[model samples]
Target: MSQKILMVDDEADLSKLVAHHLQKEGFEPLCVSNGSDALKALAKQPFSLVILDIMMPGEDGLQVCRKLRNKEETASIPILFLTAKDEESDKVVGLELGADDYVTKPFSPKELMARVKALLRRTERKESASSYAYRDLVMDVPRHEVSASENRVTLTAKEFALLEHLLKNKGKVLTRDHLLNTVWGYDYFGTTRTVDVHVRRLREKIPLLTDAIETVPSLGYKLVDEE
Candidate 1:
């Protein structure tokens, strides 16, 4: 089945243009003129991913993204922000708000399509993996569930992906850039700080991981056995 991509933008011309390109790329593109309609559409149906514009008539992209992340049913859907704002702060805020990627205005259609493919590919790859375990932490890929020390651990989608990567490479030191490229995909424009944030979250959720996940100053993180 063709993946459904929700394009939420107030610009009619741009939204139509993007939707055309998305269609050519083998995706079913659905467009919404405002954040309000975007939320309504999202609640009514499922989309493989969301292409959100930062500025809109009502609740804006950031607000919509925040609400999506806060809701369990829609939280895991990947969000890519399309905005005219290119400031570092804006990009960082979008990433922190659970946006998987960001594209500035006047972007090349080729690049945008490439990023869309990358994001979708990463999500599919993670979701298709078999269940894995590291000591007491078990990751159930099909259900997108995780448990540590026999207790359920609630993690955001990104956190779950990061933990799964660490578990797969236990005993190997993974640099921040490596983690960003591997877990977030190379199309992600954010810096390595995102890796640190997710790592901290994993440690907090699974206290046992605090001792197992080692911090190598000036390098990166390593999932190693506690000595």
Candidate 2:
């Protein structure tokens, strides 16, 4: 099946033109006129990517992106924001809202298509990995499964994220603030205790990892003895 892409914009003619181009490129385009309809469309379809315009009648692209990211099912959906707003802050806010990319108004069709293809390629790469491993420890991200010593382990999103971070940087000592910001996001600050909670839970899940990950006391943690 061709990859499905959602286009959310109140500009009917512009969306239709883009949809025509997208369909020509072998994507199934679903067009929505407002944020509510966009959310509804997402709830009903498994779109490969979303092209969202910031200026819409109802809720805007920012709100839609933020809400979609909050929902577990749609959290990883690739979003490319289109806007007439040209300020640097607008782009920054869109990115912080979890938009995968942004395009300003008057963007060339060729450039837009290139960005769309690039975003989808990146998303496909991530989905292809979906899982990471070190030794007997496995983190199946899409399935949200973690295991060690040939047994399944249950972990919270935070705990699994922490473990994934450590395993990815197996031999490095990641600072508390770095882990906190990366996994929990920069919106969460001052409560460094959250990192400790996740680390403790991760250790509980993989007891053998107890020694693999060493606490630097007041500093952070490191995964050594890597496989």
- Indicate which candidate wins on TM-score: 1
Residues 11-78, model 1: lDDT tens digits: 99999999999999999999999999999999899999999999898799999998998787787788
Residue 52's lDDT in candidate 2: 95
**RMSD for each model, in Å, please?**
2.5, 8.7
Count of steric clashes across candidates, in order: 0, 0
Least accurate 10 contiguous residues by lDDT in model 1 = 120-129
Q: Give per-residue CA lDDT, model 2, range 1-227, as digits (tens).
A: 89999999999989998899898899899998999999999998798899999988779888898898778678767788888997877876775566656789987777777778876654442455457778788888777767787787755344556677787787888999988677655543224655665576566658877788899878999998554
- Model 2 steric clash pairs: none
TM-score per prediction, in order, is 0.87, 0.63
Off by over 4 Å in 2: 125-138, 142-227
